[model samples]
Target: MQESHSNESQIQIRLVTKQSEYAVPDIPLSVPANIETAGLNELLNHLLKENKPDFLKQKQFDFLASGELVRVSLIEHLQERSVSVETTVEVEYIQVTPAPQPEDSILHEDWVAAIETANRWMLIGCYDHSVSIRTPHGKPVTSSKEHKNIVKDVAWVDQQQPSKGLVSVSHDLTGILWAWEEGTDKIEPRVKLRGHERGIDTVAVSPNSNRLATGGWDTNLKIWSASLDGDDNGEPASKKKKGPSDISTRTPIHTLNGHKECISSINWTNNHVLYSASMDHTIKFWDAELCGIKNEIVDQKAFLSSSWSALSNTLLASSADRHIRLYDPRSTEGSVCKVMFTSHTLWVSSVAWSKYSEHLFLSGSYDSTVKMWDTRSPKAPLYNLQGHEGQVLVVDWSNSKYLVSGGTDNYIHIFKNKQIFK
Candidate 1:
């Protein structure tokens, strides 16, 4: 009984491989208590040599306990599983498969012009001159009526309300604010912002949702109050008929003019600092408080899209040269990119930095591919996600788990990282 009790303390490990060609037998071994994954790996390698000598150098194997890829020591896993000698442990040995591909693809009508998400809702602007809001689970909530021309971009206004407000810019030379109430299909257009001399191209809401900025073909960036009454209610002082000139009475707080050509993109890092990119091959940083250009970055090539990282001091821009450039504002090199990633064969139209990773970003190009990049490896993309039949116009990383992309193919693809679930 004493010997049997001592033997019961040993852990029984079973090796299971997925490959049918290997013909590995179900080799079970009793290991002493507290054996870690490293020790188990060494034991498996030895067992493979004894069973099939030639298969030893074929491929490397990773051990997973109870469907989870093992990264911690075996003792930790055992403690997590609460395993004792009374139960046998099952560890799956899988050949390192490439990173999991996108789990699902969602189809949409009209070219996807822009996409933005917050919490449970995602806003999509379409080239069909309309916008639609949907849940991440792929359920349509509401769709807006057609604008005069193509919808260029969309932004979600951050507020302390149960239902959020939406702002969309269009090539019809106007920006529209819409009210979206949760648990309902009613989408009401609240205001029509008509201050841009030419067609508006992009719009951004400030971090606090108190200010809004729009850049346009007139080579200007205009800032406006996010709310009509300067309150969280988003209600106008008086109920007025909605028209192209409805909100024309309101004036811009600041009219920023520095770009030589059409403004391509705009981003507000905070309430006071705004970044604008242009076809003029320059990016200008504005101090909203002082109403002055804090810094201007000039490039030899045109910048199609630009995004500021909320997690770091890095700025990512996609250029017509089919390259994504990373910039450090604190660097002495002016606007010169600290690192450049080249993978796309055509013009890179949009770039977005991940909110969850400081060194990760996503770029979409005319080549119909959205490439995920890690700044540490500038030569190659971490993943080349292909689904769009035409140019991938925009790509956005949601809170942290999902990647949403829109393209000229009139499709929106939502990708999930399986590792994030584990």
Candidate 2:
């Protein structure tokens, strides 16, 4: 009876893969039902040993059974899901992305609240009331100390131009535009924007580089001309009293109002379309031409940050609920919330989509960690980045070669992607 039971414990599994390079023969192999993911990977690699490159021998794989990752023993997963083991199990395999390597850790004087990378430059905003520009390798170039309060956000205006532009928002309720040509000694302030009744939390440059938008704690979104060629709106900024600085002070051309609470984040998708997330538990889509809300996705938790992917036409947003959500605004049949990635233990403070891969993104959380994710594998993140000692405030994957993140720990951590994912 014991010999008969032992023989019955064995199951047949047929391995398959969508990756052409890793494809194996579709023959079923009998193995112990107690085998786990690592065991299966070893077995699959053995099958691909013949006629394969040396590098392929070192690669790892992930297995999926019935559309779910096989994280436990084969028999355990099948029994938990009430799957029948009498028949052959068909498992799909995918190449596992190696963990990103730590590249550099840049120290900051205060909490690193915001970060952006593009055009071979890295821009970081700090609670020390400064915005600093640095090389991709963490060499400081120039910085600006014109903001009176903590710098909450920063953005690159035009990466295609010879000279780059910058916009920084602060708790002082103002946004400053600056000019910095490569190798310049200073980040010269060009214009000072004042209109938000409360501290500005987020800023986004338009796709065309002709306009910019800002959202603040006053529950308002404002748009302004990004042109630095114009003279001061009124009198010379240097001659003004109790307002304006050496640079001009300009008011927003349009004020968008709909959120019932603070506007936490804003992103511009095109010249005429934009989106804003609010503490009111909603993400609103607006038509910039009409200056009104066109559609919205209501959630139970307050949104902390947002990112729009031009490649996928999808919206990614983090919330106080500690989950990162992927939404498809084009879906009119059901809920806009498509996938909810629930791994972070605390509030998800920021999210960024990979510019090179439509299916890849990153999320930083108050739990003091950053996670790399692929939209195709929604069940789990590809990697969990651990470096920050405090809440991670922002993450940037704008650069194809680098993944950058900043946190309340007063440090900017950079990682190099092994695969560029292009």
Candidate 3:
């Protein structure tokens, strides 16, 4: 018996029949071991005759359905590796087939992450409930088994937690929070958190583990608070007893309001301040108190009152009305500072801050170009990113000098500095 080499989708079991007696050779467990079994006589033998023995019935066979693994043992074996190389493919999307499994799923099967066993380069993950973990940069280091629903969004909160937990946001306002225990192959669901009135569009984790915020079509932002030791304590949700105006006192400690339309995005600067964008063509800043929001806005006068030039900070409120206003978080006082704004012909759908550079920001829109600006230079775009076939929907940067943008064309574009878009 000899070890075989293959990609994520297949495992080749090469058995050598040089002599009548042979034994299966061991393979290095570090290479992400997977096993396929066949008879020694049938291994690597293709029969030309139509009627052959049952063992040699087929050659280069494929797995119809994966068999149950009886046991998993680690072993040390000889190593032969392919050359390490790099290239980029600019396409709408690449479809990767999955390994044969007892059950099938609808996710595209790219090995987005290196096998938990090793790390180097990867574009996808295991197709059998595969959860490919990718940072803003395309370094595929970790991935888990994809669970029940397709994940709409995911966030990592506790860095020191042994099993790094991920909250997989789903379209049904319900989700499974999973954690992978270190040195083990278990990614069990911690629990299911609830309280959204409708489908969840956005979720944000506070700097501290004290709170979690969710916003979406229900036109409400619910804040959950507790100090559970990463256990499943989801209080089963039912109809609200209080009237329509009665605030929910379940897990949601605070539920903020003031948006007439569905929420577009939410960002948590710290444990207290929550910044949110909405379809009302506005961005609002909230001071989340204990189960409540400090909804007081400064009804102050604009410095450039001639235009929509209100110098407000609480409302880093920029809009398609060709204006960005800084409204007062408090009452109209003397000009503390000028509110920042940007000029876009179409609506600004999203905004992202640079992880390395504090004040640098990027915004994408119905317009094809992604404009970069700094806090001091919001009046004009510092530079433009022009490559997406359609409107850009998301823009995020990592401290490791990589910028990632995803658009409607179903492609993720990675760019470095002003040029070198991959």
- Model 2, span 66-95: residue lDDT tens: 766777787877776677778899988887
What lDDT does each candidate get?
0.77, 0.85, 0.44
What is the C-alpha local distance difference test score of candidate 1?
Answer: 0.77
- Tens-digit per-residue lDDT, 37-103, candidate 1: 5666677777778788576474555677755556566555656655554567777775542353674
State TM-scores per candidate. 0.73, 0.86, 0.52
User: What TM-score does prediction 2 earn?
Assistant: 0.86
CA lDDT, candidate 2, residue 237: 38
Per-residue lDDT value at 169 in model 3: 48
Each candidate's root-mean-square deviation in Å? 12.6, 4.5, 22.6
What order do you get sorting by lDDT, best first? 2, 1, 3
Candidate 3 residue spans exceeding 4 A from truth = 1-131, 135-152, 159-163, 181-188, 225-259, 280-289, 296-340, 398-400, 417-422
What's model 3's TM-score?
Answer: 0.52
Where's the lowest-lDDT run of ten residues in candidate 2? 231-240
User: What is candidate 3's lDDT per residue for 1-422, written digit by digit as tens?
Assistant: 22443333222332222223222332211222333323211332432232234443333322211111111211111122121112111111111111111111112243111111112111222213345554334544466543444344455444335344545444466544555554444555554667776766566667675666777778788766432233222343444343322222234667787776676566665678776666664455678774344443332221111111112123344454545454444545665235556666765555555544434556666565566664544456656766666665555443224445555544455555532212
Candidate 2 at 398: error in angstroms? Answer: 1.2
